[model samples]
Target: MSFCKSSRQQAILDAASELIATIDLEQRLLYLNPSARQLLVLPHDLDLEKERLTVKDLHAPAVYRKLDTEIFAGLLEGKGRWEGELEFRDSNDQPIPMQMTIILHTDEEGRPLWITGIGRDLRRRRRLETQRRLAKRAFDHAIEGLIVTDGRARIQHVNPAFVEITGYTAEEVVGKTPRLLRSDHHDQAFYDAMWQSIADKDRWQGEVWNRRKNGSVYLQWLTITCVRDVQGRIENYVSIFHDLSEMQAKEEEIQHLVHHDPLTGLGNRHLLSERLQHGIRQAKGQEEKLALLIVDLGHIQLINDSLGHTNCDRLIRMQSAKLKAKVQEADTLVRIGADEFALLVEDYSSLHDISQLANELKEVLQEEIDLTEHRVTLSPSIGVAFFPQDAETPDQLLINAQAALLEAKKAGRDTFRFFDQEMSQEARERLKLEQALRSAIKGGGLSLSFQPKVLLESGHVYGAEALLRWCHPELGPLSPGVFIPLAEESGLIVDIGSWVLRQTCKSLVSWREAGLSLPRIAVNISVQQLEQEEFPDWLEELLHEYDLDISLLELEITETGLMKNELKALMSLARLKERGFRIALDDFGTGYSSLSYLRKLPLSTLKIDRSFILDMGDDPVSLSIVKTIIQLAQNLSLDLVAEGVEDSCQAQQLFDMGCPHAQGYYFYKPLIEDDFIQLLAASSS
Candidate 1:
């Protein structure tokens, strides 16, 4: 029985995967099993009895002190067995951590006999424990909400981020499924597809609408991954999600800004194109006509000068609101340019209806708009183009509509015109002319012609009017009647007028240097030029630069131009008159002949319009109108000049009518600078 027990003990020791050793009471090594020799890096052939090694030799001094002072001291103090951690040194003096059990054997009197130790290597277990602690910390502090569910889809774990995102405590959500957070925004089919993807590919990711614990729906970007065990069976599902509600809201706001005008909240050019294309498609399907009307508010610059830009913008917004009220919900209204709005009319029956609509729009805008300081009327010119008749494409339609608009403005503002082939040709010519004119202005291709203004009674020259003349390299001389309106419409009149003023000043300086005396050089100014608040100061500075007196320059303004913005025009002219500059009201009796406002004007001269002068010989009404104008100018104490004295009969009629001055072919049609200088020399001689 004893032999069997010993054999059993030996077999157990040999089969152990740990270090097994026994030592005597003197601390000398007695026996070591195969496992103990391998663990201590000792040779299997070593004879422990021949070369006795003590337990202290296998341990560092500090370790042995610890074992003796703490572990062994406890065991010797009537503790039959002890189990704890300990360290031993290998052959290379490297420490090996061990989880150890020590047993003490004694006789009946309880005296110590020998010690037996069994230890297991703890390096791998310690490394695994450290990795687990780090992973848990990362899971707890991650920014994205994390969730872990068992194979049955029951919630098993949730991170703090998950709790915060869902507005739920871990205690309340530990065993609930993800369905608890469903917003019901998606039908069963959506969830079915999601699960199908997960079951097939072991992962799924997409946007999802979910409800928080507070019962509010929120959008999130969710990614779910399946976790498998060693046997390749589903163990858990790990999900990561980030809230996207705020981000989606920002994206929508950006889209709105991209498609809308900031000042008027109307659809911009981009939205116009989109809606126009869609409208065209619908119109084509239904075989109906659609009208694209481009409404241009004329005299915006005049209004802008009257009201400051802030008030001007307010007026624009108000006008846009009124325009919006006139369009159907199916139709689109867009602000495509400053002072320009476009309306897309759908489901129109006939051209007459489109015309009526355009007329209605014009009338709507013509109604005076109230500003902070002024009530002003808007002269709206509308251009209409029909789908399939004018153009088939969006770009072509827009181009055609704009061409028609230019024609409407040309015919006169406060009107509307339909697209036609002739208008298209005219638009192209106008564009070419505008480009060439800009080049001419830059390259010194423009020059001035002087039309001598003579005294009707003496036949002596008083002064000359400086007329702007442009001779294009290819198109030759262009009529002022044609290009002048073009320049005014294109807003190039301001720059051109400035150039003309400077050129006239230079001419006057040259004539003065040559000892040729002229009373003043008359320069015609447009309404656009007069609308400038800085014109008075700028003109004064130009004169000072040339060392010329302000009286040597006569600024001629048409009655029509003056009435456009009476307040601004009066202010500008009053400033000039104060500086001793000559202010002549040209084309008298032609426009807004309100003697009330006319008397209020500060004027030095009034020129009778050529139309009445040309007809005075044949038409009694024309002759009477001219006589009345002469009397009006004389009564107003304003000097008189008769324009377009073509024959001696007209000149004799003007002289007989007591008209003081006359200018026309009868004196000299328009002379060049050198020729006009010769004329001035002759008159002086």
Candidate 2:
């Protein structure tokens, strides 16, 4: 509750990753940490305190007014803080984009004393947006010629390329008839046949010689289609054509050598790369999207290792045919490697469309393929990268797509992954951590921290949740958010989960033996742990090994974990509960758990997730949700505990709402074993 800044507080602020600035009650700048100064790019000679700038000076006029009206007003009304994307101006009068979070610091007497602002620079995000705009311009002015005319054949609209290609500007061609470009190269009977085809089918396409404004004849591959009104009558004539005279012979030679894969007859890597670059440029120009999919046939090497190269080649040919049949002509499929292929898909509508095609590719490969003298089946691991979204360059796009494909393969084959920047980073980090965690779990470097769950009404310690924390000697303290998922993904959670259970039970026994009056301890249970068939038996063995009472332990499982295999999870919980182990559904109200379904589970407590409780102060919808959840817990005859009760107001609100138990920084953060035991002893005293 102290608004005063100590040296330790200043140190913490200075070390923070985000820019931090503190303003006093009069709104004058009180402190600017190194990060804040760096973000503002303040000159060395300019002393922040000496210059005496106010908080309002840091922001643009309109932004300051809006923040004062909305954010400050809400803070004055007792809301804790406000956070949003805003522009902060530096001393040079240039706007710096920031993701800003500001908090109003108040004294114990509830008088506002300080306002602290933390901002993260958004230059990278802005640069990406600017790139998209530039790409869009390139797409719009691309080299394809397009012309639209009235049903009477009078030219109505033409792009800039049309003027450049045909030697006629829009001013001269706007109202001209198509007859203006007619060439004597096509006889009267040929014109009649073309018009007859258009009349019959509403479309005509072929190579035709046309004269430009300067009287030079050029060959163009022209496609013209009749556009119809809603009533189905012809409204306009649309024409798309590109000059193909000089490049025709050159394209044929290039196509034969560079484009085709001799083995599968699909496009090769060179052609795929060219198409990817062209597709990206086109996507940028049209403000559309193209997707590059890298498909690796899983277990193909194993097939080659077993059935020889001839059989493997046959399998590759079979998959190529299956995949090619599914793709449209506008899309390009290329064989990039012996077992890997790439697809350059243009005009994709959304991520959903790309995923659907990836799934179809996976499905097609999964089907049985006949090889001479052997019947074989293969599965595909697919990775998709989007143009002008994932990367700007062709190489980066392909690399990212291949990274996603590697991720899919790592996550067990026959699946597909879409390229995301953070996911790739995390996947790489996860691989490193997986190896480290295997050592950490076995090398006795892992430990536990306990946060007491207190009674909301009386502020008495009711129980504690055992949280797992890791400190790698080399990597330093790793967050549970980082390592926990790695454990789950690498199938290391089962072993780690066992270690936590045994260690927590041993800690509880030691606490009781030392004469501390501690209540039950809750440990998180992962889906992998719960799904283990011998989990209940192992729990019993750990309880016996520690010589601890089963009633002293509680198991916390997430709502999503329970829903993963409802029947199996229910059975596991039932068996554990029968052995005097309490079951608490942690992070309640975050997942799709039904009240009717809750009635069937053998759960004893429902712990509200922190996110919902965080907004209970100002968000009416959150308040209603918490209230409904509390009511539902009561109806189900289950004890309710709210997580993240960071302030007295949230605690008092939950208590008044008839929710009895809570845990968060309002009372304590998770502590080491010695500190936790001391806390319990102090609480008892």
Which number leads on TM-score? 1
**Candidate 1 residues 282-324, lDDT tens each?**
8899897788999998777766776678888988898899899
What TM-scores do the predictions have?
0.63, 0.44
Among the numbered candidates, top lDDT falls to 1
Candidates in order: C-alpha RMSD to true structure: 11.5, 35.6
Instruction: Tell me the tens digit of each residue's lDDT in model 2 across 257-340.
Output: 788888899989999888888888888899888889999987675577557778888888888998899999999999998889
- Candidate 2 C-alpha error for residue 550, in Å: 1.4
Q: What 10-residue stretch in candidate 2 is worst by lDDT?
A: 135-144
How much lDDT does each candidate structure score? 0.89, 0.85
Task: Give residue 463's error in model 2 in angstroms.
Answer: 1.1
